[model samples]
Every structure is written in structure tokens, then in C-alpha cells.
Target: MQALEERDYFTDYEILKDPYAFFEAVRSHGPVYQPPGRDYLIVTGFAETLEVLKNSADFSAIIGVQGASAPLPFEPSGSDISEQVEAHRDRILGGDLLVNYDDDLHTKTRALLNRLFTPSRLKANERFIDEYSDEIARQMIARGGCELMRDVATPFVTLVIADLLGVPADDRQHFMNVIDAAPPPGSLNTEENDFRGENHPLTVMGGFFARYILERRANPREDILNEFAHSTYPDGSVPELEELVKMAAFLFGAGQDTSAKLLGNSIRYITDQPGLQDQLRADPSLIPQLLEEVLRLEGSTKQTARLARRDTRIGDRAVPAGTKILVALSAANRDGERWEEPNAFALNRPKIKEHLAFGRGKHVCAGAPLARVEVRIILEKFLAYTSNIDLDEAKHGPRGNRDLNYDPSFIVRGLTELHVKFTPAEGVDLSQASSQAETAQ
Candidate 1:
């Protein structure tokens, strides 16, 4: 096993495009290593990741990398670009959004956010998810296939979140546009930099959603936006308008991309494993477990970063305070020491529940329950209505950057596109499609 010295750990574009080999390399190496530049520590083992995430007291999420300065391929250069970007990040982080905070603030924000995404609410979204997925699957199968990521996963996840937040129908496209404008880690260029400067998606979406909340307060509606309009802070004071918008924006941004990736990856996995698809089709009840298995196998968020708040030792390596430590969740899920046959894709793996794909500890994803519901609903509806799914290997080869491929940002991991072909199920009646649609409409 080659040891990964501190100099060679940050994901290169080639490695990022196809990370399986890189993950294997990291696993063979010790869990902790300092990559080149001595700027960060990479934690690749399952137990090590869990240790770092669980011990948040010694780690901080505030690594001062956000917006343009957030590890993009194109460097931002102005006399004060770093300072400007840092200021913007601080402002956004200082708001009541859950991901930006730690300690007491994170706890409070998470508690309030948790209430909105309770099991009952997530379960209720199932009907909507099913209908949306059915509509997408119908269109895709009719065309003999489609790019699953763009055609099905992205739009379906986006609209479901829009509905949940009461985003007006007309503005959903605008919402997507803003999100697209935001700079992900390695995807940026000069054009992207200009876009980020002019229309930072988070800021724009935050403002847009805040206005909606203001309107909801004036004439209350039966939507989560209304709930946000009325939600009080722990101090019994209403959250500020900006805070409300930021929270909704966070949910909208985080929810759609990750879920879309998971859904697309699940479809890809099923197509890749013909036997597994048969198993799922034969026993539809296994759809839920299969989703869990898919999450473990091809997680949407492959890595997470934490800054050492104080000097700490991880697996005998000394991490200095202020050093960025990245935990590769994908590597952790495949850690051989933790599970029997860790690299194999087993839909019935009993230890699937222990995977940190949704993360763990105080900052564990609050939207996981909702995300699971979305995946299950889509898989169930898809299998029931479609058959003979096959990958379109020739036309659109894998979509992420071949070198520093798809999982550009450590914050979220997913393929840029998944193209596949499929045949509609035999004798599967679409006559009742309208009625089925009404459930989500």
C-alpha cells in the first residue's frame, strides 16, 4: 500500500472525474495524510471520518472558503478579492442558516429546521415525488431514453423543492438560473466568475424567497413558506426576513442537487447491474432498501471539510489548528475494515444504515428523511412503469470534467449527467395517469 504523503491528496480533475481508483488509493494509504501545499489533511478511513465528524468540538466548519474563493479551478485575482469574498462568506454564514454555523447556533438552527422536515411532512411529499417522477419517466421512456440527470433528476428534485417552499410557478426557472450561476468548486471560469460577481445565487434566491415569505405573512397560506413566515427563534422573536430567505435558499440549493445526483446514480447503478434491476422489479418492497444501498455505493456528497479548531491528533498524525481537513465519505463507505466485502454493491447489506452518506453528528443532513422519501417514491414509480432500462454508453459519455470530473466541490458529489435508454413496461396502463398525477398536483 502506497502511503499518500501530504503533497498529493487534493483531488485532481482526472481523479475527480473517476474517483473509484482514487478512493482505492486513499484506502490503501493511511487514513490521514497531508496533501501538497500543506494546506489540508485528508481523512479517508471510515472510522477516522466518523471520529472527526463526531468530535465537532475539535473541528470547525468555518474554513473561510466560500463563493469565488471556494477552491475553484480559476483563481480570483483582485487586490482585495480574497478579503471581499471572505466578507461575503462571513455575512452569509453569520445568518441563521444551519450549514454555516457550529456549536449553540447550529443546534438551535437545526432544531427549528428539523421541525419543518419532520417524518410526517416528508411522507406527505411522497405523493408529489411519485407524480413528478412518473411524469419524467413517462417522457423519457417515450423518447426511448434521456439524460437521466438533466431530464429526470434535476427538474424533478427542483420542482418538488419549489412546491415545498411555495415558490411561485413562474419563478422556478429563475431560481434554477440563479443556482446555475453560482460557482461550484472546480466548474468556474472567467464567465462563471463574472456571473458569480453579478448574481450570486444564494443572495438572489435569498432575496426572492424572502419576498414570498413577506407576502405569506400578510396572507397566510398552507405552505412551508408560511411556516417560515411565522416561525419564531429560540428567543421567541421572529427570524429576520434575510434569515428566513437564507434558510429557504439553503434548503432549495442543498435539497435539489444532492437528491438529483442520488436519484440519477441509483438509476445508473440499477442499469449497470441487470440482476439487481430484476430483483427490484420482482420485489418492489426492496426499493427502499435498494435506495439505501445506492446511497452507500454512490453517495451524492462524497466528502466534507472541517477546520481544526485546535491542534488534534487523527490516527497518529498531528493536525494544526486552522488546517482544512477533508473527510472522503465515499472512501469511508467503501472502507474494507468496516464491512464484509465493502467494495461490492449489496442491496441487502445490513450495515447500509451505518453509512455516513447523509453525514452524522450535529450537522448531519436535516433533509435526509425528505431525500429518502424522494428516492423511494421515484424508484417505486419508475420500476412499476418502466422496464428494459439500458445505459446509452455511446452517445453521451460520462458528463463531468474528465480530468477533475464531477465531484468538483467537496460539499456535494454527483455525476453531471447519466444517459440511459429504457422500454415502457408491458401492459402498464397509462389510462389512470391523470388520477395518479392528481396526488402530487
Candidate 2:
């Protein structure tokens, strides 16, 4: 086997599949280490990664969506490449994305996003989310087995965001179809920046949202869509129509894959350890804490890329302008310096929410709140609706020798599919369990 330094994190499918080992090896060098022959710096230390993520002025989020493997369009000349970034912003992949927005634009745009996650809106949608979770959990339990992503996470997460976004009920299936048909953005198999094409979720969904926003503006409705349609920045300026479409489309895209991945990752863990499964099933309240531990250990996003817009230093390391820094969220979350027994899953882990799974600073995931609720509720229902959950040993061999497939992408860590067997709870009514679940909410 080649040395750890010889691995290509972005292109190496093996590394992309199971990167914790590589991250562990990298951590031996220190929190932030530039691997041999690689132009980018890998930040695996929680503190070092946060320091970089927090200093947005020094680091441009222009590369946030794109993996660090993707090269920039221009070369660095001066100590500050802010002007270069602005000039060539269009050339950078995913520049127009909300995650890549910076300073004033980011602040104002995020203001509009905040409307979608308001307390009242989420509270109001609680019924729909619970109902949806109950239905999917029952379906999986009745069948005795499911390809977790296809049978559960994908459809569950897609429609949760759909209902919240108020996509017309009649057309919800079409939106799900469009999203399902396309491979997620920035998959490892595709060329960098090639994931968005004619059928891309953002493209197709943006087209629909544009029409919806325009129509809602012309003919108002008493719904979240209407609020989103009329939303204005804190500075009292309305964002352009294209901006609204991008924001809405981004909400769906981001919410779907990451949330689904989290749900699937959580279930995988639950199935792996029978004790953990029984432990969680015994107390459904522990489900939320379980989700936090899952997010920390196996978050959907592995690492996020940031470009150094100005010469800066992350602790003792000197970073010049135009450098790509890969903040390893997965690695950082498990940094031994930050957590006790980092590799172990502990639902009672202290300061659990402090993990970088959803990232930190300004670019923290806006849909994190929804993701938390979505996955937690789904797990609760799954546990209540089922007597037992276990991996389909035929498809995914025995514990030590498993055959699981993960998405071939460097940016996001997710399973391509997770096949699992489940048994429905005997003498337990889904309706009663669902009602109780909703009551606790």
C-alpha cells in the first residue's frame, strides 16, 4: 500500500469512502498539515479549522462548495487577492451559491434565509414533518427491509423541505423526481463544477421557484412561500428575483442531501451496535443526543474548502494569498484535543453541539435546525414504529467485513445506499406512537 501522503483525497475513491483513517494519520502531523505534493493545506484540528472558518476576510468562501481539489481560475500576485477574487468570481465554481456569498451580500442574503427557519414556521410545520416521518417509518418496518437512502432518507428529507417551502402539493412529486434523477452536485465521478447541468436540482428547482415566487408576488398567499416572496433584507432592500430563486433552490438542495446523509448515517450506526440500538429504543428521548453524536462522527459533509484571499496565518502556519485550505470538518470533529475519547460515540458527550459538523461562523449551515428536527423525528418514529433494526447482512456482510458503497465525492460524505432490515413493533399502533411523538414535540 502507498503511504498516507501519497493519497489523493479528492480522486481516491477508497479515501473518500473511509477517510477517518487518513484524517487520523494527518492529525499525527498536527492540526493543519500540507500533504506532500499537494498544493492545499488540510486542517484537521478543531481550533485551527475554526480559526480559518471564522476569519472570512482573510479566507474567501468562494471555494466553499467546490472541493479544494478544484483549482482556481487566476494566480495570486499581491498579498491581498480580494480584487482578484471579485474580478474572477464568476470563473470560480459555485461562486453564486449562498455558501460562497461574503460580507454584506452574505449578511443580507442570510437575512432572507432566516425567514424560512423562523420559530413559528418550524413549529407550524411540525405536524407535517411528524406525519411524514411516521408514514416512512411504517413503510420500512412493514417491508422488513429497505435501501435506507432510497426507501427512507431521500424521499423523507425531500418532501420535508418541500412542505416547508410550500411547493404546491400537486407538483411535489415532480420536484422529487427532478431531484432524484440528478446526481448530487460535485460528485467525485464528474469533472469539477460539472454537476450542474440541464437536469440539476438547483437548475430545475430554481426554474420552478422563479415561477412560484413571481406568481406569489403577483397573487399573494398566506404561506411561507408568500413570506419568502415578499421578504426583504434587514436594510430594507428586496433581493433580486434570481437571488430569491437561488436561495430557495439552495434550501432544497442543501437540506435534501445533507439531511438524508445524516439520517442514513445515524441509522447505520444504530444498526451496527445492537446495544446502541437497544439503548436508543429503550429511551426515544436519547434520539436527539444520538443524532448529535452521529453528526460529529459521521457528518454528511467531510470537508469544506476556503480560499485565502489575503496572506494570513492559521496559528503558526503561514498561508499566502490564493491558497486553498481544506477544513476537515469530520476530522476536526473527532480531534482528540477537543473531545474525550474522540473516536467513540457517546450520546452524553459534553458540549456536543460544539462540533464542526454543521460548520461554524457566518457560513454555518442555515438548514441545520431543520436537519436536526427532521432526522431526530425520523429516528424517533423509526424506533417507536419498529422492534428492531439491523443491517441486511447479505448485502452488507458481517460486522468486521462489510460491503457498503459511499458517494464518490470529496466534499460530502454519504452512502450511495444503505440496505437494512427492520421488524415492526408488535402490539404497538403507529397512530398512537405517532400521536405521542407529536405530543412530545
Candidate 3:
């Protein structure tokens, strides 16, 4: 077993492409070690990963080299660079949003978000999620087979968020197009090409959402946007129009891609393993546990980066102030030290809930509960409407590179395309399943 310091981090494209091997390598090493180039401390063990996430005082998310000017990949040139970067950073970190802030600011924002995502509210939206999921499932069943990622997951989550935000039906297509144009992580080479194409969707969506907030301010509607428009600070002053727009952009941008990945990856996993699908079909009540297991085995997010605020020790490894730390959540979930069988997909795993799929600590995902609901709805609808689902083995690509490129993103993990076939449940009604089972009992 080699120490983490001995292993190559960046050049190992295979690590990014298929992280299961990387997870094994990390487990063999100690919990934490600085990768080559000394760019960041990579924490792979579950305990250490949790420690870094929970300890905000010792670590800060303020992107800088030793708290100095951090060299960003997207930094603009000329005199406008500083202003542009500052503006972007402010939009990302200055707000009381959970992702950007720590300590008191995170607490306040989390509290506000908690109120919006309460059990009652989630229950209320159950029917809405079910309706949308059923519609998508019906379409897939009708088609006999389809590309799961683009055709189903993408549109399903996009519309769900749009509907929840009360985006006008007429503008949904335009909204989706704008979102699709936005740069995804791991596509830095294509970033310039995308920027040259049209007004960046981030800017357009920000402007449109800001205008919507203003309209809601004049005539409040019963929607999330209206609530956001009217939401205020502790002093009772509403967030500025720009802030509201940024918030909307954050919600849409954050929610759309991640959820799509979750749906796509989970579906792929189930289809590839018929036994798991059969187990799920046998006991629908185990959906929650099964979902957790799937997320742990094939989570969307792989790693997150943080900056060391002070000279800190992570699992006996010394990290200097301003050092960047990459917490590999996906690796942590598969740490051999933590789980009895770390790599295998076990629907019955007792500790499935312990996975870091939604992350941990102050910056944990705000949309986790909603995402879980969406996934559950889709799975239920899929099982109910389809008799048998399987990956098209003929369509499977070579041994090394699969047909679907797992988006080359360290922050998120998911299939680029998932091809599967299913036998549609015709003549057999879903409502009849319960009656037949009862009769058997």
C-alpha cells in the first residue's frame, strides 16, 4: 500500500473516468495526504472527510492562495478582470446561501431554506412529482426504449423545478435552452466556444429572474419565486433585486444538472443489475433504502475543494494555511475501513444512509430532500409502469470507455447517456397489482 503522497493525482484521467479504482487506492493510503504539485490535500477516508466538512473554523471556502488572489480558471483579462471576478465571487459567497457561506451566515440561510423544505411542503408536492414522473415513464414505455439521460431525466427535473418556481408554461422551452447553454464543469476547453455563441444563459436567466422578482414584488403570487421576492434579512429589508436573481440562478443551475445525473446513474445501475431491480419490485417499501444504496454506490458528486484557513492537521497530515483540500466524497463513501463491503451495491446495507451523497456539515446540499422525493417518485412510477427493464447489451461500448461518458466533472458524477430497454406493462393495471398480491396473501 502506497501513501497518498506517492500516487499521481491529476494525470490519472482514469481516476476521473472511473473512480472506483481511485477509491481503493485512497483506502490503501492513510486518510489524508497532499497530492503532487502540493495544490491540495486530498482526504479520502470517511472520518477525515467528515472532519474537514464539519470544521469550518480550521478550513475556509474563500478561494485564494494563502488568502491572497486565487488564480481562477475563468479569470477575465484587462482592467475589468478584478471587478468581474469580485462580482462573481460576491454573487457566489457574499450571500447568506448555504453553499457559499460558513458559520452564522450559513446557519441563517439554512434555517430559511429548512422552512421551505419542511415535511408538509414536500408531502404537498408529492402528487406533482408523481404526475410528472408518470408522464415521463409513460413516454418511455410507449417508445419501447429511449436514451434515459437526455430524453427522461433532464426534462423531468427541469420541468419539476420550473413548475415549482411557477415559471410560465410558454417560457419553459426558452428557459431550458438557456440552461442547456450554460457551461458545465469539466468542459473548460469548450467554455470559450460556448461563450462566443450567445449571451451566456447565466446572464439572461439572471436578468429574467430579476425581472420576475420585481413583478412579484408588485403583485405577490403563491409561488416559490414570490416567497423569494418577499424574503428578507434579519433587519426585515428584502434582498436586493440582483441578489434575488442570483439566488434563482443558483437554484436552477444547481438543481437541474445534479438531479439529472442522479436519475440517469441510478436508472443505469438498476437496469444493469436485474436482481436489484427484481428485489425493488418485490418490496416497493424498500425504495428509500434502495435509493440510498444506489446513491452510495454510484453518487453524482465525487469531490469538493476547500481552502485551509490556518495551518491545520488532518489525520496526522499537516496542511499549511491557504492550502486547497479536495474532499473526495465518492471515495469516502467507498472507504474499505468504513464499510464491510465498500464497493459492492447492497440494497440491504444497514448504513446506506451514512453515505455522503448530499455531503455533510454547513455546506450540505439544500435540495437533498426534494431530490430524494423526485428520485423516489420516478423509481416508483418506473417500476409500476414497466414489467422488465434491462440495459441493451448490444449497445454497450468497449471495456475501457463506456457508451455514456461519465461527465468528466470532479464536482458531479453521472452518465452522459444511458440506453435501456423495457417491457411496458400493458393490460395489467398498476392498481391491480395490490389486489393480486392481496389475493395471493
Candidate 4:
């Protein structure tokens, strides 16, 4: 291969398949190195990435989703362009997103989200997740083979989060129908002139949430949606209807996409190593450790964008206000300086949770607990239901020359689809599992 540094990380499609090598090529220049000819900075250093994620004051998330692909609405005015950003926030793509808000607004809007992902809430939702995972597992077993992403992960994740948030059972099919037709979360290209804005899943799902929020406010119910509808900020002021809808929709979209991708990543790695696969099947307790390693090695999110809110120094490089910075989480996670064998997947890596995959500080993925439980429970189910799992050789081709395709997105890194074949475990009783589920209820 030619010098990885010579490739344009943004526009080059082939580089997306394996950007880590490119990241390493850049890291050799220093973690905080600016690519030659690029107008923005990309942070690959472990510590520097955390520094950017932690100090939200100096790094604005206004470009959090769009990244350097979409330009700012207005030019930087001075040493600190905070006011200039606010003045044109409405015109900036993704500026209104919960992930894009900064400082006080971010803190406040994020506060209402606590009720959704709390330990108590997640615990209460576990029984449903368990049943759903088992339900999907049984289906996979009956089929003997499956398209993992479409047939399994996507629907499995979507329904699980919707159920947790108290979307009425009758409305779930409608939710799926709407979501099935829209762009995968984190796949939007706002830079396109003719982008189909109507096709965003959030726009349709937000309407359903709007109706539910209104109904809940008029007659507070005993469900999670009631709590969600009535959640307030630190000052106890109620957020507007629009804000509540965005929060709920954002939570559902973000959680579903990342969790499903994590599941896909987990299965691919586990099955790729037969020893690791056998270890997981024999000792289910190691699933959690496997998850942590998976998140560190092949996280669902590749990178998130940050705008320098003021002139600041990241390591040796000076980042000016308005300069867009791509917080290369994948690169930071695999920084050789931080890990002994950075590219290798080591299940027992020390301080495993320290990776910047879910980001850090206030903007850390709020739905993370739910995501963990979702991926974990489903993985446990897959193992329980199958005697052995193998990549469908016909679909992906022979081991060395596989044809698995990653989603062509600028932000998230995930498979476009995964086809797997499994042998049903002998003596595993799905009927008994269903009976136990009914008995518990």
C-alpha cells in the first residue's frame, strides 16, 4: 500500500474501510497533528482526545454530527466566536441536535435525559430485554441462518428501546415501518444539495412522540413516558414541547444505531476467533469483558467533530477558534502509546473502560447503559441458542477474501449487513424459556 498519509481521509471511500492504518500514519506525526492541506485538525492522541472531550468550554459540539463535511453558517469574528455561532445556530446543520448543544444548554437539556437511563429504569427494563432477545434468538434458530443486521440487530434494537420508553405496544409496528424506510442513524449527508430531508427517521418518530408527550402531560400516567413528559431542568422549568420531542427521538435514534452496530461488531470478532468463540460459549460470564474490548477495538462510532470555541493549544499545535476538529475516538482508542498491542483485541486489557469510544464529559453517550444491556442480553441469547456460529462463507466469501461491507458513513463505522449461519444447540429448550418468562410475569 502507498503511504496512508497521502490519502484524503474525508473524501476517499477506500480509506473508510480501514482508517486505523491511516490514523497510525497520522499519529506518527503526533496525536495532535494537522493533516497537510486540510483546513481543520484531527486529534488521535489518547490524552488529547480526552482533553477535547472534557473541556467543552473551549471545544464546541456545534459541528458534532456534521463534522468538517458541512461548513459553519458564518465566519469566525474574533478570538472567541461563541456569539457568532449562537447568532447562526439555526442555520447550521445539526446545530439543534442534543449532541450539538454546548455548555449550559447542553447541561440542562441533558439533565432531563437522566430519567431514561438511570440504574433503576434500566433494571426495570431488563426483563423485557431478556424476553425479546430470547424471542429473536428462537427465530434465528428456526431459520438456521440469518442476515444479522437487517433480520436481527436493527429490529431487535429498535423495538427494545421503544419498549423501554413506553411506546404503546400497538404503535411499535408503525415505528418499525417508519424507521425501515429512513436513513440509518448517523448515515445522513447534510452536505448533499438534493438530500431527502423528509426521510430522516427522527422527523417521523418525533411526531409520534409529540402525540404521546401531549397525552401524558394532560393525564400523567404510571409509565416511563409520563416521567419523561414531566422531567424538568435544574431550575425546575419545563422544557418546550419541541425540546422534549427532540430529546426522546434523539435518544431512541442514537441508542438503536450504536447498539445494533456494537452487536454486529461483537459477533464478527467473536466468531472470527474460534477460541474466543468457544470461550464465550463455555463461560458466559466473560461476555461483559468481551463487550468492553469490543467497544475499545471496534466501537460503533468512529469519530465526532468539535469546533474550537476559542484559540487553544492541543498538545503542541495551536487550534484557532472556528477550526473544526475531528475527535478521532477510534484512533485514540488504539493509540500504541496507550495499549501494549494496540491493534490486537485483548479481552483482559487493564483499565478497559478508559477508552474514548463513548466519548467523555457531559456529552458522553447518555443511553450507554441501555445500549450495554441491549447488546449483552442479545449476545447471551445468541450463544445460548446456537451450538456454533460461523460467517456464511457463501455470503462473505472464503475467510481471507471476505466481502463484508461497512456502512459508507462519515461518522459511524458499522457493517452494512452480516450474514451468519448457526447450528441449533441440542437440548436447549426454547419452550421452557418462554414458559419461565410467562411464569415470571
Candidate 5:
């Protein structure tokens, strides 16, 4: 009914307000689409999205530059950006993180990461996750209600990640403040803040981590940061301090930010739907499935950018080298051909764990396992302490029919704020809850 440009999804505020229908419209058109005036190709179908992700040789992720976690806008510059990108990528040790590398280099970097995220460290971190989740839930219940994003999800995620990375308790508040001040990844605000001198959250975070990296080297500890400080590539070459700082800072931001979005969205969804909330509280074991359904139906990450290295055909469309392609992870997760009643959030949905919420192939999210553990613990703690959860209609709109307000950005799908009220279970006390949490563990 409308022209393609008329339905411009990314920049159009109205479409972004409720993006699923627009995503479905894009999928219905074809697997690969080049919208009017936009040079980049959008891969929407599940199969097509997989093809691009799996075959990095055909579609290179080496976009010639790096910064925050968001994808750069797809507009082509006449001059080659490769040289500048090369300089950035080649700036050894922590200079180029996981996302910037491909092929052999990507593999090597990933191997080093694997060393850092050992199974034992992850298991040990679960104790801290439980402690952080319980403390945050206690505060939320005491407040009676809160803007879930700011009060609970954000701080909960930030603390767990900080503890995991061995960030000092005294400095934890500063780290939280820094992350809060930083704009969501890929936002223009990052650039504006950087231009204003010394205020950019990423820059501050980089400096903090850089100092910590040096400290960890001088006085090694049993934390992951120390592991990174002492790590070497397969060839036994040590990464530069700058390189280590860049990677650690990126992880700190990316880890907390995306998990907060996921946890907030999951809690808001269940709380908004009373039946689902009750179902989950009655049988708390269902939370893992509930989270999987959340990931499938509405994931935090929506899209990723890739460049075509050579002539490539996705379905029927032929793409030339250097063409930037937008792989729609959100759209692919809802493809009807692959998922039954794909739009419905079914807790028992079969094979739902296979969803592409965390991209596919080599560049899949490194923090996915940690994110799962964090959200799962938060949900469990909330259920243990609260009898009921409901929307704070006075602050957010009408009680039963309020629309969920989401951030107006293509890179991350999350709420700007989610006000909610929690009803504590009868006879529930913070001390008792903490004891029960320990016993359960």
C-alpha cells in the first residue's frame, strides 16, 4: 500500500514504535531487499541470514573501522575506508577486538577469549550472580515499585559483571555511573560526548580498565582481568596494554548493557501479562524456558552489519563486493517457515533455543552464556521474593492497554524506562529470602 521509502524502517519513528509488523512486511517482500535510495541489502529470511553469517569469506565483517558495539550506517563513502580501517585493525594488542577480526585472526582472538572464559570461572561467577540478584530484588521490594530499568535491571547487571571482572567494590559505583552516562552503543550521543572532552563513558571506561590492566600485571590476582593481562596469543605473543584495555572495556559495556535490556524486557513482559506472571511464580522452574521464549520473541540485539567481499548471490539477488549488508536477526527469529506460529511467545516452544537472537556462525555473541546465567538468577530471585508483579499504570499509561515504550534506535531493542510495582509474598522478609537463596544454592 505504500512505497518502500515511505516505509523506511530505521529512521521512521512510527514504524520503530511497533517494529514487528514492519519486519514482517520486509520479510514478505523477499529474502533480500534493497530499499529505495539505500545502497545496502537487507537480508530478512532465516535461511538467507544464516548464509551471510556462516560464510564470512563471501561476506566480510572487517568493515575497516571500529568503535562502539553498534553497526555503522550503511552509506558508502566514494573513497576507500580500507586504509583507515586497516590502521585501526592493525594497531596491535587490544586495538582490534573480537568484532573487527575475521578468518585466521578472528579464530586466534576467539581462542584467547576461550582461555579467559574457562568453565571454572563461569561456574564461580554464579555465586556472585545470585548475591547480586538477591540484593537488587530486596531493594526493589522495599521501594514497593520502581522504574525496572533504572532501579533493578541496570544495576543488577552492572554489579554482576563488575564482580565477575574483579572490579573493586569501592569503585563499583563509579563504574555503574559511567555506564549509565554512556549512550547506548552506536548512538550519536557517543560522538557528541567524545567531542566535548573527557566525558565520553567509553573513554572513561577505557582509562579505568587501562589502569586496572597495568595494576593486574604488576600485582596479579585470581580474577579474569588478571587472566587477560597475562594471556598470550597461540604464538606466545603478549597483547599490548592498550589492546587489552579496549577489549575489556568493550566487554564491560556490552555485557552489562545488553543483559540489562534482556532482563528488563523479560520481567516487563511477564509482569504486564498477569497470567504469565502468575504461571511463572507458581512454578519457578519454568523461568529458563520463559527466558528462551523471550529471546526468541523479542531479543535485545536486532541487526548486525557485514560487507560483501566479492560477488555474492543471496537467494535471487546478486550483491557486488563492498556492498554493506544488514542481516536482520530480529526478522530471522520470526520466520514462519522455521518457527511454528512464530509471533506467539510460547513457553513450550520446541527447538526455540536455536533462535538467532545471538547471531549465528563464528561471530556469535561471546557473552551469551553469562547473560543467560544472569537473567535466570534475577528471575529466580524475583519470583522467590515477590507474590505478584504489575505495571505502574499511573506512571506509564493506562493499566491494561498501555503500549510498551521502547528505545528509538535500530542497534538495540530495549525500554527507555519500565515502571512497575511488586507485591511481596506473605511473611516474606529480606533476611529470610537471603537465607533461602543460600540454602537453594
Candidate 6:
């Protein structure tokens, strides 16, 4: 393996777009390789990443709780980050939201948030996903082709989230417009400039929920938002409005952004491969399996940052306390040492569930179940309604010679846009049928 010194992986937007080569070059030095320019180490081994995830005592997600908006300076080699992080906790975090907490608080918060994404809620949303997906397919077929990012995936996922959150129909369009105008799902542009960082999409969403919570408190209604408003902390105290806003905002933004990326990646993969689309059309049951392969190969959130709470070892490398480690989920999933044919999209891969697309341990995505439902429904509808799906060479260039665009970010691995054509299936001409009926009348 070749070692590239201080590659500056984070700031280089072009390199970040296609970082597989970089990952391959550096994995040999991991489970704890420190890239130059940056002070942190990168955890590249599957087992090692798992160790860090499971042993939270030595690793804290407090840095993650601070997240992109309020990142602190990386402490020098021997210094502890715990103190620095704790000092600015309130100013940086405002208050403890789900991702910011650890131990008992994280446990209780997760339990409370679990009420919104329960199996029953998912089951109830199944019909809505199916109907909405079918509608989207019809729209795509009518257009002949679309920029899948804006036309299909983003709208589909956003609508699903709004419905699940009990946003009234009349208010849904405005909400989507607000989210669309904020920033692209995976872009780090906001992190770079802090432009409207306060009114960023997630914050805007939190603000919306904040008002709704007040209204629901006064005029209690039968909806998910109402239930969430009533949810209490583990100490049996009702959380303040601002806290609820953060919770609502986190769930909505995380759910919508990740699901959109997943759908875009899945479509790009299946459409690019020959015979895969037909294979999936023939047996829709294989979709769940295919989605697993997609996750393993192209996880939406590629990697996440964690701060080491205490000095520890990852593989043979000794990491000191306060060390910032980038857990490479994408690299770990493709570890040739752990997976046979790791890079290939093999639907029958036996250990598919081992993939960390949803992260691991306590911080696993809460909205995963709903995301799965949305993707499966949309794929099924797309395949059912289209005879053939192919990339719009005019929009995205020729099949093998296209400029593949990805969101330039350290964490989000997703296409910026996917333009594709869909040939309507035989006997499936809703538009034509409507025209014929109009003529007959």
C-alpha cells in the first residue's frame, strides 16, 4: 500500500468526490493511521472500528454531539479533550439533543425518540410510501426522464418525512421548498462559511416543529408530533420547547437527507449495471437484499468522527487521549481482509447485515426502518412502471464516459444529481388513456 502524507482529505472537494483510491492507499496503515495536515487518526479496519464503537468508555460521541456546526480545536497529543468539550458544552450544543448525549442520557433520549419510529408507525406509513412512490413513477414516466435528485428522490423522501411527522397537507409544499433552498443534502458549504448556519435546513425544520409543538400543546391532536411533544426525559421531566425542537429537527433532517442519498445511489447502481434491472423486476423480493449490497458498497454517510476519551490502542497503533478518529465506514465495509469480493454488489452476500451503513452500537440511525420502507417502495414502483431505465446520456453524458458527480463532503457520499430516462411499460399509458377519454367525451 502507498502512503500519501498529509493528503488534506477534508478540504479538497475534488478529491473527496472520489476518495476510494485514497482510502485504498491508506487502509494498510490503519486501524489507526494519522493522515498529515490533520491531527486525528483514521480507523480503517472493520474489527477495530467495532472496538471503538462498542467500547464507548474510551471513546465519546460528544464531539459528534457538537457535530459540524460547533467543532472545537483538536487537542494536542497528551492533553484531554473532555475538559475543553465540557467547558463549551452549553454554548456549543445549546442543549443536549440525542446525538450529543452519552451513557444514561443517551439511553433515555433514544428510548423516548424510539416512540416516533416504532414498527407500528412504519407499518402505517407503508401504504403512504406505496401510493406516493406510484405517483412519483407516473410523473417520471410522463416527463420521459428526470434529474432524479430533485425530481424523484428528494421529493419522495421529503414527503414521506412530512407525512410521518404529521405535517398537514397544505403546509407540506412550503416545508419542502424551505428545505430545498437551504443547502444540498451532503455539501459542506455551510460548514465552510457558516452562511445561514443558524437558519440551515435542519434548524429551519426545528423552528417549524417548535411552533407546531406549542400549537399541539394547547389543542392536543392525534398525530406523531403531538406524541413527541408529550415525550418526557428519563428523569420524568417534560423537555423544554427548544429541546423538542432539536429532537424533531434531528430526526427530520437525518431521515430525509440519508434516505434521499440512498435512493439516488441505489438507482445509479442498478441502472448502470446490465441485467440487474430485469433481475430485480422479475423478483422484487431481491430488492431488500440489493439495498443491503448498496449500503455496504456506497453508504450515504461514508464516515463519522469520534473523539477518544482516553488513551487506547486500535490494532497495533497506540492512540492517546483526546485523539480525534475518523471511523471510515466505507473503507471498513470494503475491507478485503474481512469480506470476500467486498467491492462487488453481491445480493447473496451472506454477511450483508454486518455492514455499518447505519453505523454500529448505540448511535445506529433511528430512522433506518422508515428509510428501508421508502426505498423498497420507490424501487418496486419504478421497476413496475418502466420497461427500461437508462441514464439520460444527454444530461449525464454517455454510459462509460460520463462525468459522475458526487456531493463533496467528508461524511456524505451521494450523487449530486442523476438524470435518467424511463421507458413506460406496455399497457401503461396513463397520459395517453387520459387523452383518449377526453377525445371520446
The runs of at least 3 residues in candidate 5 whose Cα sits more than 4 Å from the true structure, single-residue gaps closed, are 1-6, 64-95, 188-197, 431-441
lDDT of 3: 0.68
**Candidate 6 all-Cα RMSD:** 4.1
- TM-scores of the candidates are 0.85, 0.95, 0.84, 0.94, 0.89, 0.91
The numbered model that scores best in lDDT is 2
Model 3: lowest-lDDT 10 consecutive positions: 432-441
Top candidate (TM-score): 2
Residue 301, model 6, lDDT: 79
Question: For model 3, how does the per-residue alpha-carbon lDDT over 195-285 read when each residue is reduced to its tens digit?
Answer: 2234655566777788888899899998877887888776565556765675676677678777888888788767766477778877888
lDDT of 4 by residue, 364-426 (tens): 998888888889998998898888898999899866577888876667788988999988899
Q: Is candidate 2 or candidate 4 better by lDDT?
A: 2
| After superposition, candidate 6 runs with Cα above 4 Å error | 1-5, 65-84, 91-96, 184-186, 191-196, 432-441
- CA-lDDT, candidates in order: 0.68, 0.85, 0.68, 0.82, 0.74, 0.76
Q: Write the per-residue lDDT of candidate 2 for residues 112-146, one digit (tens) a residue.
A: 89888988888887889888788767666766888
Question: What is the TM-score of candidate 2?
Answer: 0.95
* Backbone clashes in model 1, listed as residue pairs: 6-34, 6-35, 6-36, 7-36, 13-403, 13-404, 14-403, 14-404, 17-405
Cα RMSD to the true fold for all candidates: 5.7, 3.3, 7.0, 3.1, 4.4, 4.1
The worst-scoring run of ten residues by lDDT in candidate 2 lies at 432-441
Question: By lDDT, highest first, what's the ranking?
Answer: 2, 4, 6, 5, 1, 3
Error of 1 at 65 (Å): 6.1
Extract clashing residue pairs from model 3: 300-413
Backbone clash count, each prediction separately: 9, 0, 1, 0, 4, 1
Error of 1 at 312 (Å): 2.8
